[model samples]
Target: MSKQRDYVLRTIEERRVKFVRLWFTDVAGALKSVALSPAEVEAAFTEGIGFDGSAIEGLTRAYESDLIAIPDPSTFKLLPWRGETEPTASMFCDIHTPNGEPSVADPRNVLKRTLESAADMGFKFFTHPEIEFYLFKSKEFGPDGPIPVDRAGYFDNVPGGTAHDFRRESVNMLEELGISVEFSHHEAGPGQNEIDLRYADALTTADNIMMFRSVVKEVAIAQGVHATFMPKPLAGQPGSGMHTHLSLFEGDTNAFFDPSAKYQMSVTARRFVAGLLKHAPEITAVTNQYVNSYKRLWGGDEAPSFVSWGHNNRSALVRVPLYKPGKGNAARIEYRAMDTAVNPYLGFSVLLAAGLKGIREEYELPPEAEENIWELSQGERRVMGFDPLPQSLEHALAVMERSELVAETLGEQVFAYLLRDSRQEVEAYRRQVTQFELKTMLDTI
Candidate 1:
């Protein structure tokens, strides 16, 4: 057995861990877990537990259903929420075929492939996600619609509020699970909270995000409240978004930083942002996957209607934050359009591929959107060469269908699966009779 595997097993025993859980995500980023006794932990670490992949969403067809979850030794953690006595621990798994080849349909494998591609070109993909979510008092579904737990406005620090306590518990839970929390605070919407995770390599960060969501939900339920990462859970409030910070590194150095360049951007940084802006429209369907995600984008409040980049500009889909006076690693671009609902595995893969391609082809960064994009007139926007993002899911999918970059990044199975699934979602939305229609035109027209 590998030293790392023995270390995990030894640690579990020392901690009195009665059960060891193997965790992984399917294509849609839902957390899935299965547990084994302490007796089986060592073998599980060396080999893997077999499961039927046909049951997992977008994982396999029944004909080729065998799969295994090989635990990532580096991700082992004893669960704090499970308490100390007769303890339980968990590890994120990398799926593989029984014969031990990495499973092609695995979301984690997709990201691994992209990272390997980046490594081949002497770069590493790193990402930080600013996760946004809402804390609701109750999550009971109603015929009318969903409702928020609080009436608090943006950043309203409700002293001893349910949300306030929930944040404390959530952060505590996350820390116990070995996920670092950079900052946690009330967002611009009532019942909304944003927790920023410190940046890490793209693969680990994606795993962290999946765990982050699950941890938040678990903590909320424990506290007798409901938590949701749905982007537009409430109508008037600003929507939840998973704004991601991205940068490339070569060994220990930040590849995006240059001390003497205009805006302190390296040629590589400019092209990377240019690639993001160029492909932003086509990749929208992946980042903003759900039908409800459009409600957040179109609701304004500077939720990005166009593709452009500027230092400290919040209105653009891509923003290059002003360089810190001396911090090199902090030099990175922020992508603002992605909501919290995306499959982070696929989302990060496509983004890295697009940016790497930009570096390879020398994509030129467009003029910065210095002016408020939401306020720009059509003619003015045209003059400035700023194209608006797709206003609807249908439009977003249309663009995605024709993008060779997206297809190549996602591979054949995922590209076709996502397109097919997203279309059905769009069709379902079209068939629904919404509150707006009923209230506005039901009797008036």
Candidate 2:
């Protein structure tokens, strides 16, 4: 605390950092911040910022609304996306109850709880998230509705297009923030892009995910474009999904690697994967939380709809990339279903919890899907023991409702809140009149 306090004070004085924002997230993963001036930062480190908790989504009730945000010195980073000039620095915050306990509503804390379980097991979870999102030309509403900026095809590099320069600038900013971008390209859908981040520990990755979203949006707006992480922004095209790559490590050793095992999958890895496959339907509502998320799940080009694992098969829900011969650190499992629209903190926690449950229970993994399950006929799929994932948000909620694992993982507060919120979203969506209905029924009448 003393050293960081000195560093922050030094940075502010030397670099002319005027504001230090304590950043945190709501249950819905929207970043919230409260700025502290240079004069009060030292005291802020000792005494947290007091605010009304009731105002935050999924936070405290109105009557008992006092909450605090304690700055995490370790996450101190200057916001490069803020501007090219005298920049503002920010730190991820820890939400605290009045009595100084970690707030249960904090998504970052939720992941920390799950990480504690992993830490107890003598392992640290590392994650690399391949986050996907869409870009659209800034538009004003006409009589109809919103529209995309361009009609570019998958990976089409339009010469001198505004989106091209926007992506370039976004990548540059991400790199400056120490968030490594392994790959960035246009997605199958027009105006969509995917950027793969190098894997790191779960907490850092979650924090980076938070930063990445803001940076992308900032860059987009600077170039007169709008960026959306909405799972399915367009119809009849592939949707944006954050197919997360996860691994377990024990003191610099990859815990999930064994040369003697089938496909070189260790028992621990198989068990973890098994737990994910088993609990997948239950966590669908969390991984795909939004009402629009279901549209992407069913659109079908790349979004996985079956609970099956494969070696290099992108179609299956989970994939184990064939290990690069000597690349031990890079060997990991990829979970296909999670999207950027989902809250990373809660999403990662639930995922790790499910996988850890498998390891603890020694759950047996099913046979690997050697062939593309999508290519197989319905009867063939049945023969191969492949079952389709939950088909809708309603169906996902039904499965989640019955899942003791998910219930336990999320605990009562979040579990109840998520289920109730999701149901309302589904119902609200169901009530809305759509273009499909109008087009089909109005002409017929």
Candidate 3:
């Protein structure tokens, strides 16, 4: 056995862990777990635990249902929320077929494939996400709507508020799991909050994001509140977004930085931004993957509705944050269109593929959209060559259906499933009688 696998087994015994949960995610990014006894740990490490992949959404067909969940020893961490008594530990798993081939439908493998491409190009992808979500009084809602835990606004510190305590406990739990949180604050909506995770390699960051959501929800429920990563949980309230800061590195040096270049952006960095802008619309179905996701996108606020790039322009889809002089390593681009609800593994895969395409093909970066895009007239935006993003899920899927980049990045299996899923979502939504329709036309005409 590898030293890491041996270490995991030794630690489980030392910690007196009664259960070791093997974790993986479905195509929709929902966490799935299966517990193993200490006796099964060795076999799990060596041969992997078996599961029915057909049961998982977008995982496999019934004919090829049998699959293995190979536990990654390096991801071993004791579940802090599970309590010290009757200890429990968890590790992320990689899904594979019975024949031991990597499952094309496995989201993690999708990302791993993309990262390998980056590795071949002599670059490493890193991401730091500012994840945002809302806290409600309860999961159930009445005729009115779900109630916010508090009425606090952006950065407002509500003394003895449920949200304030929720953030504190959530961050502590994340730290216990070895996930480093960079910042936490109240966001610009009632009961909404933001937690910025420190930068890490793309794969590790994706794993952390899964853990982060679980930790946040666990903390919220313990505190008698409900948490949601729904992109737009309520109308008239700013929606939650995962504005991610992305970078590429070549060994120890930052590939995005060049001190002599304009805005200190290396040619590589500009190409990366160009690539993201060029393909952002096609990838929107995955990044903002729900019918309600469009409500948030078109609802204005700080969400980037148009495809443009600029230094420190929050209104642009891709923004280059100003870094301190000589802090080349800190330089990166923030993609603002993605919501908190996306499957991070798949989301990161398409993004990395897009950026790498720019690097490989040497895409030319366009002029910066210096003025507030929201303030510009549609004609003005047109003259400036700005294009709006897909306005709805239906629109996004249409664009994605034609995207060669996204299809090649996510693999054919996942690509076909996403298209089918999106079409079903749109059809179901169209069939529903919405409250807006009821209210607006119920008594009129």
Q: Top lDDT: which candidate number?
A: 3
Cα-based RMSD of candidate 3: 0.8
- In Å, residue 84's CA in model 2 sits off its true spot by 5.6
Candidate 3, residues 1-445: lDDT per residue as tens digits?
A: 8999989989988988999999999998999999999889999877998888989999998998999999999999998999978899999999999888999999999999999999999999999999999999998896768899888999998989898899999999999999999999999999999999999999999999999998998898788889999999999889999999999999999999999999999999999999999999999999999999999999978789999999998889999999997799998999999999999999999899999999899999999999999999999999998999999999999999999999999999899999998899999999999899999999995
- Between candidates 2 and 3, name the one with more favorable TM-score: 3
Model 3: worst 10 consecutive residues (lDDT sum): 142-151
What do the candidate models score in CA lDDT, each in turn? 0.87, 0.86, 0.94
lDDT of 2 by residue, 316-381 (tens): 998998898777766689999998898899899889999999999999999999887778898988
Tell me the deviation in Å of residue 1 in model 2.
Answer: 3.4
Ranking by lDDT: 3, 1, 2
TM-score of each: 0.96, 0.96, 0.99
Q: Which has the better lDDT: candidate 2, or candidate 3?
A: 3
Runs in model 2 lying further than 4 Å from the true structure: 84-86, 139-145
- How many clashes in each structure? 0, 0, 0
Candidates ranked by TM-score, best first? 3, 1, 2
